[model samples]
Target: MSIAAGGFTVMEAEDDYVEYVPVAKRRALEAQKILQRKGKSSSLEEDPEKAKLAEAKPSLLVKATQLKRDQPEISPTEQMVQQEKEMIEHLSDRKTLMSVRELAKGITYSEPLLTGWKPPLPIRRMSRKQCDLIRKQWHIIVDGEDILPPIKNFKDMRFPDPILKMLKAKGIVQPTPIQVQGLPVVLAGRDMIGIAFTGSGKTLVFVLPMIMVALQEEMMMPIAHGEGPFGLIVCPSRELARQTYEVIEQFLVPMREAGYPELRALLCIGGVDMRSQVEVVRKGVHIVVATPGRLKDMLAKKKMNLDNCRYLTLDEADRLVDLGFEDDIREVFDHFKAQRQTLLFSATMPTKIQNFARSALVKPITVNVGRAGAANLDVIQEVEYVKQEAKIVYLLECLQKTPPPVLIFCENKADVDDIHEYLLLKGVEAVAIHGGKDQEEREYAISSFKAGKKDVLVATDVASKGLDFPDIQHVINYDMPAEIENYVHRIGRTGRCGKTGIATTFINKNQSETTLLDLKHLLQEAKQRIPPVLAELNDPMEDIEAIASASGVKGCAYCGGLGHRIRDCPKLEHQKSMQIASSRRDYFGSGGYRGEI
Candidate 1:
């Protein structure tokens, strides 16, 4: 039985339709058409006008069938139409406003997005309130320039003699601001919380202190029992731990050759040879850089001990929470007993982290190198509002302009893969990395990117934290992250270590109002001027003074006082008023009598 045109079921004699399925003629027709499109012959192709006949044929068994005939002659115009259809399908994958330069096998050039689509404008601007705060900094910068380190002088900090010598030989004279403020306290064994944007030389702040401690320990004490790592550095992910480990390794080598060195270390991360890690641990390493999970696993099995854990560092503390490794963090903290000095560094510190901070540290000195998620002043932030359809087109244009190293942030793993594949098909060099990618592969892609081998990297939030690719110039939000906090880490990839960088976000009308508002809040808090288009978009801060004054809001909790807070209250103000009242009473012979000194 066959379904002719106009939905008629034609039941053919079994003998006549011997080669066809007995009752699946309808299913077979469309299937056959596709096969013919691929240049393969099908039973239905033999009957050129059979589909149009609209005649029913009886079902048949053991029916003999004719082979398909050639397709109708295609006109040049029809061929053009077919070619265009294919192109449209290809272009569908490469949307406008999304410049997808995937970093796979070196970025391949994909034809940019549709013509005539304008690059998007930024979604929102920094608020006016934030703008005012920024202007104040310039004044302070000028006034303080004389008393503070010059920009170049930052690198020439008065580090300790040995550390200074090591830095000079390594050509690392100037300290990044994070290093400037953070290193001192960290080296002092003061538990510190470091909050700086990504790429702000935050690693060095902790690394320098770690080295100093390691050196001090080397000088004062003999090697500890077991291959237990003396210094424990924990991160959220394997890639980050490895990345940090490698970076610290470079600085450590020079120090090792020069002074109290011999700093053996164990890498305890998942997805590697466990026995090998254990062997290294058995050999007594100086530092153990690890992901929380593998470290916890080893500790649970009693594989290592922190009997000598003197210095502890948690990198990307916020990311550790995000990765659902909060328990592991607690365990890592619990594992290290005694009065070990600890350091926790994160790009942003939410309330939850503050809770963790309260539990982990002993009256730690807090250090905020930058506002949480604030755009680095050194980085240029460009906003472009683009429609999803036009995003790929804008991306292509953006890519053509600057082939600089770029970190592309996608909202999800699926999007990362889809965008990565589409860019690849479009001949754009790119690779997709999510939590899904194997650790080694992720490392390879990141390493390739950092080495200046890959032009673009498509990643999820994992790469947004603790990534130290200082040369990254453009951070393109192929899609805005749902969480505004992630936005801070994303742009932070560039403009790090005090280098100028650029961040461009593509927005469309469909861009969430809430997202733009949050972004505006973030940028404004960072002290950037709001884009004119979004000037009115910012919600004005409520006039809180009236509310404050009506209830004596400024009164100190410690003392029932007006015109002053108890803690920092000026005694002279009350004393001066009392004198005035007393003088008036004396002149009038009234009850008031106190006088100023």
Candidate 2:
């Protein structure tokens, strides 16, 4: 017995007038006839047995359509229910349809019906207790009219199941304060400015929402090439951009398993091939993690545009402005013709940054996890007064006294190289990085240091901004930063994520007069014990401001006397001008007027 054409079973006898042929042979014969449209005879015509078998076969197309295939048995009622679901999904809007398809593909979620694919919940009013809870418990203060629902945990939040699962897999059992508060505002489609400490899990606060919003918008309408990315993340350094790119890539793994196509996340940074980057943009991208310099270059070459971009984020925004990226950042914003949601995250918010936020963000809710520019409460700070000639001796003592996994920060490349060389001569496992080194050398130094191959890493301000090295036991400020905000960021490398660490700084008389007053106050605020030497120096900035205020008339700055300006006073004119010119000459000598005060 054999199953033949149309799934019919037949019992054949040895002498019966029946010819048997395989289904594969019948299809091949039909394909031969179609290919030889010229009516040329094939092997079947030349062979009597094959011809007889071919003649017994039915039309190949009819046989293929009529074949009964093996399928799971489904009851009539169950089949009717599945058909109804298919009909509803087809009639729904694009986002709803996509949601249904995603559910069928194993992406689980508990949110209610999607209203035309809109976010699960709209902006809602909160009670007084809710507001106070966010402020008092989480230390997140909001300053805007946009109300937001409180997200107590990931399970209750409106995030897609794939993102939530990725979070769990990443070992994030609880939401950081920044995430607990910032996620709700951003997911509600409101602009936000987040101020938090280093290693505070601020990256995921915006990244999760950025991906979700971009994907949702893409489902509704596809993005066009050269119209810019759906989401743009700008940082100050190439290293920081690369870190963000890796994080986003990690989160996208679960989404890929849920039958969603892998998104194209591009790293648009410098020190790479520009032509290759341009070619990538020519195809398309969902998200772009970029540094200001390379992104500006791409825009100038017309390789990319941001007219249709829907979401924009600036990580370490204060550092970006300080590094003279203010103009480039503004230029990038000029191309946004459509409405965009902007988010700014920084460890500190200076007055200039506040002004920038006021202009760039539209009624943004300000979220602060701690006081701006305040050192981490978990870090123990210490300062030693060392002369210029004896600084290296003191640094050697500190290194010998401290444990492994130490980071040393220098003011310039010259000091970085000198310190690294001295450490190598002393048989210390160390590596160095600065702006002067090529990209490959910098990357290798960082990698070796991260892998524990090098115990100490010496670098300039390039490493001060956004590099994350886990378990950094101590930070040595070889030279104190010129600005107070920078000191906060430099020492942030240690004492991260509530882990206690130590930071030591070398202070000379030159820094004592300018930085001591501010440093003293900062140390007191962070509850660190202040050194008697630093507590004795008076704040020069305060004295200067007091002198300016006491002189009520147009007078000489040096003598604070009326009726004579500093430039015209015979007693101090030449001396004052010479002093001003001397300071500028030494400070800006290498770069000339380009480094003006």
Candidate 3:
């Protein structure tokens, strides 16, 4: 019934147009300010007398001199741009993302205030060669020598032939831990809750099973053609939805090629054309991938129907919980039939989500491959203490020296822009991804980055979970995370699949007081070397890197101490968490009926 055995899938994406919503709006004002700054620089060059007077001022003289030392040799205007960017950073509250972008787009010395019109941005894409070159550089940096864990093959697993075909085409010969443990439960028509780290191939886990159900339906009604998907995939961000959509499309290719390929796909996300999206739904799609808010709009307009949905996959389930999508998610679940299959995937399971998962799944199976609350030690952690203004310089210098395929994680979207624009001005190959971008542009940014067209990706919490970047060599925490758990997941991007990677974080003086305390505790537990500032308040260190080493040492193969390997241990290896959680339903839904086999 499905071409999954061949690997191409019918997928979805925002068609094209994007709207300018305030929260999701691009900083047109900021972009205009930068342009004005440029114009001012030109004026300075044109007027020698004015330039001489400007440099004569004591404040300006010291700044120009500092800029000369801190930044790479560039034109005078470029220098001004760098200095202005630094000044603006101090003025931001660090509370909101849009504000950060506005701050980043500040004017040069020429234009004092941020008022002016900037042209609308046009679509842009990178050449394949440029992207391919970046992709190829990854193997050199990632470490996978100890990564010989057996690939989980569920060939004994039962599924429709269509799925088999799709897998063959996509080259997914084996299931990852997430796919292997989670799929069969779902295939048996049961709900599932999966908790694992990033880069664990979480996407394929639920995607393949949904494809199978679609395939099975096609077989029952051989000539039914594309009645479309019996599934809905709700994601946290547009970029992730687009990424998932593209991957799904790849799986749908053979179906389209085999005929009866009118399998429709629709995308509903903020900052994009809603009416057009509604039209696509009216035209009919087999599946819908969306952010919660946009879907609310679609449902309000009567353009989407969840009444027929028999299955749902929640990606980044924890993040969705964090983003306050509970009510929307509940609304989505309420629209589904009582016999629906719900699959929830997350990197870490907070108790709040555990309760929600229990409520949603009917006797669901819980799979834990990496163990409970375990940090993936594959990524090497590195740290530096510096002034807030120095961060712009530190990041640029770091990239120049160890520049490899890298992902930069920021505490917030504003910080994402701060790092993103700093890199752009320095001519570093980078792009930013956050909820702020319209759905289409977000998708484009991810595609371009994955294609290896980009060297560095500056992202906020958006990229912190449920993402895969197989060749990433480095993950930089531009600022330390407020939550210890986020730190565990953010750096995990690098050391995936047993590959060795590195993570670097910058801790500045102006960090929020509460966040700094939490960060200090986390670094201490990790057993990393804490800076001298905290030495007096800290306990005596048995090890040199007292602060960061506490949680970092690989549990003793013997005594479970970090310093010693298991080779010297006298005890046998022991397993941690149970492989599954007993998924028992509390009570049957009123007037519910079992699904037909």
Candidate 4:
């Protein structure tokens, strides 16, 4: 049988339709028939005690009124006690109890400030002319109030005696431009965003401040088990995290030998046994250097936390954002239980990164050693127009241009392997690293190259972002990267510590015209000798300056690519389409509209 209801048809068996009755009505009809046939009392009627009890029960409104009258008024103190009891019960979990105990201990403990520690004196005390001259001499551009004077030497900063000795031991007698100005801002407890050339001692700018913060916290109140990470340094890659961890460890050794409070630093990164990291965290860590993925995992799994983390540093900030770690970074921020001194250090400050900084950092002072994205003046840049087929053959000649400890960056892992094997066949001491390699292999390659045991290290852009090889004499770009920002970082691997180095790049027809244009501009800006091929390609946007003036923006504001204006940016368009596709997919998947109209 078929029947129609609303706009759809319904089919049922013939007997089902005839015999079906509403359940409520059927129950009532059966009760009536039972009364008629056997004259039996209903269950509720037969239970006299239950019926009487039901009659005695008051209505909800009456009961609520009675409850209000029966309860005694609680004093504010008694209410607070109740609240405390409830909170303690809620936080009875082991992890939360540990956090509470550490917080209580931190609040109760007190100690004198370390000897020789003093607040940084303001630069305003100096004559205006002297201050101007000092900034000009160091090429330091600072944007913030009451900026501290640049330190002439390590002593001017008033570092502890052990730190001074350690500095001298490492042959670092004077502060670099960024360090001179940056150290004071961070030590003063102000947030900062530091921009400088890749090899301009940017690491020390944050690393030293991190050590100082961790040391102060430890002295004031040592962290208990499962209760720290007083200072946190988040890097974008495992190699950078390892390097930063090592720098912190090196600084800690001197303080330990000087009989200071014992402080522990932990390296949390992927491709290592998580059990080991958990074990270290359970013991307690004063400082943590980590990449985003493993750090997020540890935080999510309740193995570690940032309840006491008072200092946060994002090294290679631009690279982190570019590599799509921004969400992970924000998620990590959610784990922080209090305000922290945030420091963002990077070689390039693109518009996207600048926006991210404004949103993430609080009233940060920006210190720029040179114009953002500018090439290092200390490096001699050479560009060659070589055919794609002949590029591999010319690699041998390029290797001879520099001494041992040279870095070669390729765009692809397969190319890195090819070049590495080719160099080995020709009896060159070379090592290669890329994402394809395991952690142990990558670490060995980097360590061997840094130790000068390997004459050349070939790798992808993974090595280019923020890996510091202080003795590297040359950097060769096996292929120009897709973005101009990457090209800047690639060449910056050399020419560190005020020492001059060389950068060589090979270009061919396979490269894009936009990239060639950006390279031309960069070479022109750096005053390097431009190859004939790059010199001939004219920028099609002749009215770029006028357009920028009208729009109140300069360059490609989207991706910060210098090759094209915003309207012509391929990356911008690609990102826009991707966003649209993602939104559409989300909409359809969310069941917004799936059926035909």
| Model 4 alpha-carbon drift over 4 Å, by segment | 1-124, 548-554, 573-597
**Candidate no. 4 TM-score:** 0.76
Q: Which lDDT tens digits does candidate 2 get at residues 1-597? A: 665877776766667666777999999999997887644347667778876876688578757666644456775545544553443244222112112233345443222212232223422455667667766787776677644655667766677788888888877878888887788778777778888888788899888887887677667777666545888999988777888998998877778788765566789988888888877787778889999888887887778888667788999987776565766777776666555778888887643356556554666788888776667788889888788889877887898756889999999889999999999998999999998787788889988998899999998888888678888989999898756666888999998877888899988876634345667767867778878897776543333343334433222222222222333333233334655876788887653222100
Q: Pick the candidate with the highest lDDT.
A: 4
Candidate 1 per-residue lDDT, tens place, 111-186, comes to: 2111121111221143544433543432211111101121223323334455566666756767665565565456
2 or 3, which is superior by lDDT?
A: 2
Provide the clashing-pair count of each candidate structure.
54, 0, 43, 0
**Model 4 C-alpha lDDT per residue in residues 1-597, reported as the tens digit of each score:** 688999899877565457669999999999999786564235548889866776698679989999999999975545544553343233232112112433455532122112234444654366767866988999999987656666677776767888899989988988888987888778777778899988888888888877888787787888788989988999988998998889888888988999988889999998899999999999989889999889888999999999898888889887886665766777787787766778888888865566556544556788999878888998999999889999999999998997788888999999999999999999999999998899899999999988988899999988888888977888999898877888898889888877899999989988888878878878887899988888788876453555555544455655556667655666545556765876898978864322100
Candidate 3 global lDDT = 0.60
Q: Rank candidates, TM-score, best first.
A: 4, 2, 1, 3
Best by TM-score: 4
- What lDDT score belongs to each candidate, Candidate 1 first? 0.62, 0.72, 0.60, 0.79
TM-score, per-candidate, Cα-based: 0.63, 0.70, 0.60, 0.76
Looking at candidate 3, the ten consecutive residues that score lowest on lDDT are 139-148
Between prediction 3 and prediction 4, the one with superior TM-score is: 4
Candidate 1: which stretches are off by over 4 Å? 1-166, 169-171, 509-511, 525-597
For model 3, state the Cα shift of residue 383 in Å: 2.6
Off by over 4 Å in 2: 1-126, 223-227, 539-597
